[model samples]
Target chain A: MSYAALDLVMLGAAALIALVAVVFGRARVSWAAAGLALAVLLVATGVFDNLMIAVGLFHYAPHSVLGVAVGRAPLEDFAYPLATALMLPVVWEAVGRWQPADVRTVIASSRPISWVNTAYPFAAAYLLSTTNISVTFVVGTLFFLVPYNLLMYGINDVFDYESDLRNPRKGGVEGAVLPKRLHRPVILAATLSTLPGMLYLLAVGSWLSGLLLVLCVLGVLIYSTPPLRTKERPVADSITSSLHFVGPAIVGLALGDAAWTPQLLALLAAFFLWGYASHAFGAVQDVLADRAAGISSTATVWGARVTARIAIVAYALAGVAVLLSGWPGPLAAILVIPYLLVVAPHWNVTDERSPEANRGWKWFLWLNQLTGFGVTLLLIWWALGR
Target chain B: MPGVYLALLLITLGCMVILDWRYRLFFWRGPVRAAATLILGVVFLGVWDALGIGLGIFFRGDSPLLAGLTLAPEFPVEEVFFLVLLCYLTMNLYVAATRLLSRRGGVGGDGGNPS
Candidate 1:
């Protein structure tokens, strides 16, 4: 599986620099700082996705080869990291350089080079292609995922208008808000982008794939705009947001023409756990804004303290699901147990309004990522037949 | 198979229209937002559809509610129908849960207080 020897070294360098950038500020350093950050970014994504694919979690046709095939991993998977590094910084820069203060500001402003915004999600999907690549996958991405994300971000901005006005830094007002008028245009863009993919699927006689695309388009529309503005409500908001995370991975079932297996089910379960944990914990940060906006998020309804607890439990569940997927050994499982028991139990009790919960959630989120990585390694090992 | 497809289409359309009507006629929120909600319903269905295909959970066997679109041996048109209908109901239930909790001013300080 040791493909792309040079690429691996570059990725290592990128990771090292990213560590420095995180410690200091990226702005304080040169473009080399951002360059280094970008380098390892896509590599990390690709390696992970590639490992997942090789382990029967999913599969992807290699667009390129780097001469390493441990079971079925290709050298091109390394490019995913490079792509991520590039796209992430692009988005970071775009949001910082071109964002407006409000929806009106966004609508009125004539920003140059705004198309760069599309790169991140595209890269996200493309990196995802390390797992599965089909016309349906692309359609699910451009039309459904990207549009839904933009709309969700816009609606979140709209709802948080007042809170955002009060706390500019935290709301992180760096992107243009999708104004009411732009709603249809965004949807139209999403819908139109899927046409080629859809047509390809139709021609291939993959009617189910085409149907998935149409349905995904419909899903994004309902979540963002109006009478259903589901995000205005609590649990629905969480579930809708979760679809964004899990929906893309749905291609797993179609990959390599395999049936849905227990391992895939475990991955989906992990997806749900992560989704719930992210929402329950993430909502903690926005309780005040969500409340002011007439939104009933879990953080608002359950209280941040309870929400935090739920997040911990959800995180724990995700960890367990990963463990049961026959990857990480009992030790890795044991490693996370203490944190789940000790740290998570007291995350938000004393100061619901304090940033302590966010800090803890961040830690736990890392644990989540670590578990994902560990599980990937384990799956690779499993594919190797122990 | 065709009958199953027709049934599923009807169920899905029915759910979409109902949810759309609720948002459009009852909520009085903007049309854009309402449309977004319906789209969301569809997105959930899509996710479920994908997962259903992937996980083999709750698939149709000898009997299906709808027919016509049997692209795969394991799936029917009604499968998509069930995905959409089930997802629509699930989303609505979540919305209701949020609403009910908000109305009670249950927890989380003034944040929980409904408008």
Candidate 2:
């Protein structure tokens, strides 16, 4: 069987497990939130994946696909996000069953808005590197889309519960102020959910791919966990957070057995810089909250003004880095302009007023969608040239 | 005439520098940081371009205005000026835009420490 077929079966199984978990789990369900998440997933996947396929960024073998199309995307493409939308809340709700009082809080901590962030990188990288569908691609995509995020953000919610309670930004879309009672269960859930996927991936992946996957998981753990909480280390915090995103792509490249070309390296470097700048800028909004909680970060250490300036510099450098990736790639350099503009107004924000940067952070989220569209256009151009 | 593109690029960069100094946009505020970012940016982009050229994704398009000078096979001298202009212009635009917005009370208006 082709990778697409295997991917569909695994996704179906995952969705079923999540559904059963939600049905049995005692945690209260929010039909509204679930419906909203599903709707967003449908629209995003239907639109973006269809466009990517239509433009030929990558294509599935005719026999490998199910022959069903939603716009230009194969029907199978929707399964990844659909499974994610279902599995995340189900996992959260199931875990929350252990601490009934914190059920609502755990559900909110899934950070549904950012779910696509992890999934897209893995799916896009894998698809781009390997023109053909394979089981490794499917398995890797499923892992990153759901369990990887659960381990990354779920563990984060548990570990940061104390500081989250004090941060005004918590208890909402930014994060969930997970209660103390739910901490152990949340950690248990994250570990339990990720272990199966990790083992499956390690068995299927080459040694290089397995090592990169391990590093990716380790990045997620160390960024939030104690003693080695890299998030508490100013500049290192940005680098680690950046790795959390870049690692998945690296793993995809390794699994695809793609040759390391200079242009590819340049693109990865540019992506890394963009990720670092994003994390650093995001920290600016939490400067006061972090300092108040005795949590050190790039923003708290350098002060918000300096941190914002540095973020701008990093963004600019990212744009320059992209310029060397060749024709259509150079066009992506323009994408950074929007991001630079979004953070530009907060240039002089002091620590006391750093929270005001949240306004820009909000815009940053939407800017990501816009920038994603721009990148898609460039990808389409590159594909057309090929 | 072969070096016309390079010469024009340098002249445009010079104009940008003049404007930046007159407006105290970037370098005037933090010369050290600005210089460091510029140098790092140029070096990184240069290496990236060299790599791309080496990998054969990039090739210098022939033109009468081209410098006809080679940094390496398939790599052009004009690329250096282009990278410098890109970094210089982006930094200047970023700084000038921020200063303008701050003055307009669009950002950081509460004495830089608004609680």
Backbone clash count for every predicted candidate, in the order shown? 35, 0
How does each model score on lDDT?
0.45, 0.70
lDDT of 1 by residue, A1-386 (tens): 12243345334433443343233222122234334444434444455445444434323323323456544455544443352342223222222222234323433221212222232223343333344454344443444334444444544445444455554334222344444444333333233233333333333334554464445445545565667766556677667666655554453233223345675567567666766676667677666655665666667776777777777887688778756554433334554564476446556563337345556555654565555556456545554664
Q: Flag clash pairs in model 2.
A: none
Q: What is the DockQ of each candidate?
A: 0.01, 0.01
Q: What is the interface RMSD of candidate 1, in Å?
A: 15.1
Candidate 2 lDDT by residue in tens digits, A120-228: 7777778777776654566577678767877888888878877887888777677777777666556654554565567556655689989998999999999899989
Model 2 RMSD in Å is 23.3
- True contacts preserved, each candidate? 0.00, 0.00
C-alpha root-mean-square deviation, each candidate: 25.1, 23.3
User: What C-alpha lDDT, on a 0 to 100 scale, does residue A128 get in candidate 2?
Assistant: 75
The Cα error of candidate 2 at residue A15, in Å, is 22
- How far is A160's C-alpha from truth in model 1 (Å)? 6.0
- How much lDDT does candidate 2 score? 0.70
Question: What lDDT score goes with residue A65 in model 2?
Answer: 61
TM-score of 1: 0.44
